[model samples]
Target: MAEFTFSTEQQELRKAVRRFAADNFDEETVRRLMESDPRFDPKVWARLGAELGVLGLAVPESAGGVGGTLVDQAVAVEELGAALACGPLFGTVYLAIPALVAASAGAARDELLPELIEGRKTAAFAVADQAGAFDPAAVTLTATDGDVTVSGTVARVVDADAADVILVAANGSGGVGLYAVDAAAAQRTNLVTLDLTRPQADLEFASAPAQLIAGPDEAERVITHALQVGSVLLAVEQVGASQHLLDIAVEYAKTRLQFGRPIGSFQAVKHRLADLLVDVEHARSTAYHAVWALTDGSDDPALAASIAQATCSAAFSRVARDAIQTLGGIGFTWEHQAHLYFKRATTDAALLGSAEQHRDRVAKLVLDTAAVERVPEVAVGSPR
Candidate 1:
């Protein structure tokens, strides 16, 4: 993989996003979020939607999206990650956007994509089950064609209650399929989650009418592609959280005095911080490769996605744990923000198969390729 340097335009956008995040997403505001029911601040979400035009970044320009590639979405996600912005931007912009684009057509794409871009319509991608697995084949929700409806229940759906459109993965006799379910058409039940910053809900499709956006076999492919998008964007977010953890650690090391010297100046603390920098930088390289591969519409997108997911998952865990350690006693307290980053990393990592799972996938790819390239041995070395 080559070193990634953002384009001049991307760099400028990064600066803009940074400024926007700094101005809006402060510690106090995040603290207030802990008290809210939905966890996300709608005002902040609308600002990102209207002012930043984030939801449209990955959607086609024709459909009212920014007409940018997945790489562009990764850039925006990095900024949001840095701020630890508590919103459904990740769910809408990165996860749901691509799935909808792949599955919907005609009026669906033309109508909904634009609304999603403008933040007029909130959307969520429903794939994961209660077990934390994102495999669409494991989807127990059945969409049966009845007199007036297709009905089923989807559990552990992210941002389902708040969304207007849901891209659902359903299984039937035909196999896996994708359906665009109107949230209003189904009975939505709100649910509590460990991560308050991101709300979740259960979607009960009690004979609800739905449009079949994708065929049965295509559903898994679409879901996998969406998960790929989610994995890379989540990597960008992990980068943000990791970068912030580094910042917190550095600040604490410099300001906090121990034994008449700054803790940051201590060799042990310095080395640990250096190690963190290496992890974050390496994760950045893998993430950039994944994003580039995905946006380029290359043949090896899945391999790249696995690499990014594997690398970033480990990087996030390292940065979060080290951030807490560097803060010593204060880090363990709920008053500090270290726990927030820690929780976010864990939540994001657990969403799309853990680091180990992705690593195994990458390993399997390598093994399969090697097996295909192997040649039969000659008997007693008598023949070539």
Candidate 2:
């Protein structure tokens, strides 16, 4: 098999996204949008989809997308994460679009995919609860047929208030299914979230009209696949954020002086940054491996994803918190951009699943695989 390397096109795409983020996602613009009612600029989003083609970066061209690989999509998402972009990209592209594409072709997929790729509309995926449980049994909302009206509530839906449509997992007579509900038909209440850049909303529905995207038998498969794919992408995002935090902290250490000398000259500060550098680099390595595993149909994609999520989650959370400590007083202030990244890092650690959850999952997968293979348990991470 060929090595997992970014093509020139992918590298160029990353540069383009970075440039776009630099010009459009300045601190002032991000702060303003974070406090605004809509939370993001639609025109900029349209440009991202229509002009830059970031939204459809990985969608199959046959499905009216860019016909690129998942690596291409990751490149764009990482840049967005670094920029702390305030947009519907995470909910729409990562969650909703993947679910729609995975489901068998139908009215919802045929109609919504184009509009979504063109950035004319936005969507939210409510497959997981606040705890990040996405199993069929984890779903609470119930859907009934004969026009398919769903009743119940989906909590912690990313960008639910800004979504034109919501792809939800609900229990019905057909068992757990994926349903597409019109956002306007549901009650959307924005939450007081720690991460203002990535706003979330709670959605309540009382027999809201919907279309079944994927039925019981296939819903679980589709949902699990989406979750794993999302996990890999999310790990990549965490790596990007960690990189950003490290860069800022290192720069601050060099510039800030104490006792007539740069604080970076101090032994304690150097060790702190050196440790953070290891964490960030490990995060990037693990995340990239997971991305490769998923893209290449590796045997242990689940294991790879869990490991990546576990490592990246802890790494980003640590980097974000330590960045504030490194920056001293300015990092904790509301006016400084450090708080913004810190908030995002803290929120992201819990978004898909907590690091502890992922660590538990990784243990389960490794042990289960070992049991199947009848391999001797040689204490992992223990010296012989």
Candidate 3:
């Protein structure tokens, strides 16, 4: 087993996030958000975004950020997942900002990055159609005349209503490109989504004007960055959900008696819970590796990301289902909150890309790298 160690700063950040989530984003707040029309409480979001500076964690110092890395952001993601809060922070901060930072340079980045760091503007990655195929080549949206006109609709975008800017991936002259579209110019139709807590929308661009932020090849560049960051961050969130599920299951097992004693004392329950612990720990190692690679500029960030996403997705889903089973009848009730975590876990597992997709990518990457190693270098006239 790999050992886990955290720096003092990382530990402090995690503690602060845990306290904030526990205080503000409890079960009652989550229920209220789910029931409400717009979905989240603005005050709580402001506190998280503006007060705590959660949105700026991954942004660089040149862009007015605190100069933190993906690992720092991952720590906060865990807390947010644990709370099950309904906010646009993840979509804006994790997906959009990272993509922008990775893709743009010069004047555009100078103008956009600072605004994002300050939380004055919100951005979303407008990938993924109704089919949930997040491929760059699968994008049906079109951007013509270099940057002037954009057409086609993007389905199921996270936090589309709150966005000031949207990073749109579309088919352009030289292959797939990324454009920074001003949200006010486009037509946004809010959708009745399954996960009500997280607001989603369908956006239409009828020859909408956009700025050419990233030229051709930008879609792959930006999506790769988004996936690399999201894969690890999503795993952190899964860690939080899995831990929360375990805690809930343990408490329920202790209080709810079966066969005259606490059900937790049963060998079957004990073994199952023990197995869950092992899965969670395994996920922790892979997630930590992914974050570390992203932060340290490792050679294989994408491969690390695929491994983490695949492992963490499985761990979270299993933990969530087992938790529901452990709670028996009450877990199935709408009033009970176990189902909320379960649903969120399911949705998040399929975000960015599915676990099966990631596994396939991982396999190809490994084989490709192995094949590259078989070719021997020849010195001018020396070796064949």
The count of residue-pair clashes in candidate 1 stands at 2
**Considering only N, C-alpha and C atoms within 3 Å, which residue pairs clash in candidate 3?**
none
1-384: candidate 1 lDDT, tens digit per residue: 555578887888888888988887887787677567666767677777788887667766666667776777788889888878877765687677766666546555566666777777778877664222256656756777732245677776777767888877776567777777788887888887666666778888877776666677566656666667777778888887788889899999999999999998989999999999999999988887778767765425557777888899899998999989999999999889898888888877877778888888788767766444333211111112
Q: Over the full model, what C-alpha lDDT does candidate 3 score relative to the true structure?
A: 0.76
TM-score of each: 0.89, 0.93, 0.90
Between prediction 1 and prediction 2, the one with superior lDDT is 2
Of models 2 and 3, which has the larger lDDT? 2
Candidate 2 segments exceeding 4 Å error: 1-3, 129-133, 369-384
RMSD of 2: 5.3
Q: How far off is residue 370 in model 2, in Å?
A: 5.7
Candidate 2 C-alpha error for residue 371, in Å? 7.8
Candidate 2 residues 2-108, lDDT tens each? 56678899899999999999988989999999999789999999999999999987777878889887778889989988988889876888777777666778877
lDDT score for residue 283 of model 2 = 91
Q: How close is each model in CA RMSD to the real structure?
A: 6.9, 5.3, 5.4
Per-prediction tally of clashes: 2, 0, 0
> CA lDDT, every prediction?
0.74, 0.82, 0.76
Q: How high is the lDDT of residue 309 in model 2?
A: 85
